[model samples]
Target: MSALIDRDEFPLLARAPELVYLDSAATTQKPRAVLDALRAYYEHDNANPHRGAYALSARATERYRAARERIARFFGLADADCAIFTRGTTEALNLVAASWGRANVGAGDEIVVSGAEHHANFVPWQQLALERGARFRICELAPDGRIDLDQLRAMLGPRTKVVAFHHVSNVLGTINPVREIAELAHGVGALAVCDGAQGAPHLPVAFDQLGVDFYALSGHKMLGPMGIGVLLGRREVLERMPPYMMGGDMIEFVHDDRSTWNVLPHKLEAGTPNVGDAVGLAAAAELLDAIGMDRVRAHEQALVRTAYERLSAIEGVHVYGPAPDARSGVVSFTVGDVHPHDLATILDARQVCIRAGHHCAQPLMRRLGVAATARASFYVYNDESDIDALVAGVRTAKELFGHATV
Candidate 1:
């Protein structure tokens, strides 16, 4: 994995030699391949796809369809048309809430979501339940921050319509058992929706193998650009739901009184799409595939192990989330007498970039009894030197705050 980072390939990392970027969970740094692919698409094939028949349009359509195929193949989906492009994970979840939830979930139905979900995953379902007169249920989190599977089983019943949860907790870094959870949802005759924003980039995600009805992911969280995300659903299930957004390109025909909708994927993707971002996302997925997810996961795991050991050794530092062996790359902690915002500012002076906020998981933060925490999350390019810089930064912050030890 060390060979994966060639200084020549990533000129930005070389340019900012002192910067230790540990915020991969928020968004990862793009590789040269993804950047070049975006550049090449805008330079050569800059045309609206699927509508025009000229040479440029033909090339654009080919590239767009190829991207769908690449993403579908990456997730081991049978049909590329099962995937739909959206703004990000937030929009993807909203689509599910508006389209599938509106159609399948009703007055007596129940929608179950985990307590540890990001606001993107939680609010959409909550809103849908409220509007449709459906019962909204929350699955409790265990002491270690993972979902309480026993509680989840007890909550699932005939009234349950959809079971929504994150594949990995953004704050806790607790990887959920998607296959088991999906089976449990199916046992209760409910659809399972997985928010894969955090999981897709760090681990190997095979949508079919996970047995989920719907899986949502963001491009930026991986190595792709912003404003692009994906929602992969089972073909038969998606076909049953009404279109979430109504506009051009999503319709087969329009009349004064009624309008007919387009086919599977197109029906879901409305209006002018984010073509360049989709191209960049495809390139990002290709880059990750080349590196191999297993290798990427292993690289990040080693970094997390080292970070956990070093941070835990500090006297006044309190680490959150699962133990080192039971976690992903995310490490959240608090320095004694220093607010997370202050700790972040101190760390930033040393060129150490870490996240300090609710991390979009305010409910989880409340559960942990902290308003915010300082988080250092790792990725493929992060190494031991990065962890060392973080350790040194924390020590400097402790000393600057007049703490004799830590």
Candidate 2:
């Protein structure tokens, strides 16, 4: 299948036609629609939300609310209040760890996470466990770079307070069975936390149906602007947790000694909201919804599989993760004796962009017995030509590195 949208739709890619952007896993190329939405927000509704009494401020507040509602509906969330605007997945996970984990987790309790988690997901929980005297249990990955379900099941018990894992592995592109993981956590009476920074962009996500207590996603990875993300939590769970922050609009009443908190989202969001970014993200969600995620997923899979096959056929190349059918559009690999940074530099020389280093997955890197790996990830604006450029650049890098990979 062809890509649902092409480079022409992305201003950056359209201007640099020769540049092959395979780093969507880090951040996607923003569509013109998203950029337009952002510009429109600033031009028309540029004001502080919630606290302002003026007309422009009122419009900004309404835009923020409407954006939240639209994004909630996009992700199958029934109540927009349950979706908290966050700086990014990092901040969202930290909020859960700081508020929910702090309140609920205790001594001897277990917090289970997979080896494949990004640092944002892994570190907060680990730190929480350490601070609370809880057991930070890590479920190591299977040989295929996915979390071992059997291992996870054994890790969960009555003492388990949380079972946190990634919906998609940023390093290996393995798509974990989120529903099954959530079910296993629920069986042990634990809350399921999902690091959905990667999965939400390439897959059709229904937050309510995914059976997770908290799901976090980044806007920049899904054709939206940076500085915007969402943490979709169950309403009941959110109500029980204390406010993650205080000040700004997240207040009901204030006194000299004590203060009452605001309701739902405002209770969690403590500062002036990023109305422009939220508007951009809502436009991105609408664009994706119109194009249909089913088609987007299929197109990405096709591109990644092509890259996987071509890369694997090279004698010195080693591809990580499960088969193409079992993962998203990310492909992490290494060429014999060629450092990932060096390979990335070579690729850059050819106007092909790919992510290098540990890919922010240092634990998984250690588990896979590597210091770093080169990653090529895709999105709707990516197509076969990008894959072709990537393969060619990689082949060139192998030759330059004295590997003769072909």
Candidate 3:
């Protein structure tokens, strides 16, 4: 483990000495800075925004807008107004499905999603397609758990209105070529929508560079507070799309008879928002920026490489996903004769927290021919000691399962 980052920088890790938090793919542990930000917001600025002209309200509104700017800059978006805040990645996807899909996708039009998408990314499109009489097509995954580019090319056509897929597989950990996929979607006259819930935190992402129509990411999974996510799209696209919700704040003019809606971001963010969570998310983004995304990527890649090598060395452990070079920070595997749930329990007993089960990617699990698997995901705070604990926990689990060593 490199001594680049001090344990004191992350209070959660510092306090929880026995806890090996390896489930970052699910939700990351909040850093001290983020928690402090959340505390400061609630303790001081507790006013509802965009309504009152009071000092508190103005401060709240300023904080909210600044959070948007922070997140927009983090993603390399051109305009902060283009980023709409939501509950989380699930809500972000649903907003796009309701707004963009309703306006653009119609009967006989096709929407393509990869088979490896989490249910958050899959069900919204599926439900929308059912509602609009649109054709829902899935891009097949290769044996190594990447999108089959040949099949993607064949499946896309003139009628394809939207291509929604994960930038990184939540289950397989396969990093999709966003630029290539976006270009392919454009070739078929389709809008490329990327589910960045799994990608944004681990990898450096540029919305403009990827040429994506929309990108969704969760705050909790990126060491920020829960209940806040971002949906970044082109200003033109969001301006044309209808609001997902209707209420005060998102209105231009209103009467008993009719009303006009607010502009880009406010239109989508209806009702009172998760202001504190958004502030925490901005702080988290700033922390990530300070560390530098390239360094973060390098640290995670090193952890993943170390994890893959160590886990693969253990007998009866079947690892999933592409090679370490092809994947990011996730490692999903199953041990022989031990149920994933059982393995998870044992690891938990050892204070080695890992995610088990389908990980909200049931379709991908079906493709992998498993009901569940144990997944260990690394993050910026993780080090080789964490990986060693995971490997040891798995070995102990296998031994408890009474498997013979080869």
What is the lDDT, from 0 to 100, of the residue 226 in candidate 2? 98
User: lDDT: which candidate is best?
Assistant: 2
Model 1: how far residue 306 lies from native, Å: 0.3
Question: Could you give candidate 3's per-residue lDDT for residues 1-406 as a string of tens digits?
Answer: 7623566678978988888988989998888899999999999997999989899999999999999999999999979899999998899999999888898889999999998999999999999999999999998898778899999999999999999999998877899999899999999889899999999998999888989989999999998998999999988788888888998789999989988998878999889978899999999999999988888888888888999988898888889999998998899998986888999999999999999999999988888889999999988778888998999999899888788643
2 versus 3: better TM-score goes to: 2
Candidate 1 Cα misplacement greater than 4 A, ranges: 1-3, 404-406
Error of 3 at 162 (Å): 0.9
lDDT of each: 0.89, 0.93, 0.90
Q: TM-scores of the models, in the given order?
A: 0.97, 0.98, 0.97
Per-residue alpha-carbon lDDT of candidate 2 for residues 339-380, written as tens digits (9 for 90 to 100): 899999999999998999998899999999999999999989
Error of 1 at 56 (Å): 0.7
Candidate 2 regions exceeding 4 Å error are 404-406
Which prediction has the highest TM-score against the true structure? 2
Q: Write the per-residue lDDT of candidate 1 for residues 288-368, one digit (tens) a residue.
A: 898898887888788888899999999899999898767788999999878889999999999999999999988788888
C-alpha displacement of 240 in model 1, angstroms? Answer: 0.7
Candidate 3 deviant stretches above 4 angstroms? 404-406
Please rank every candidate by lDDT, starting with the best: 2, 3, 1
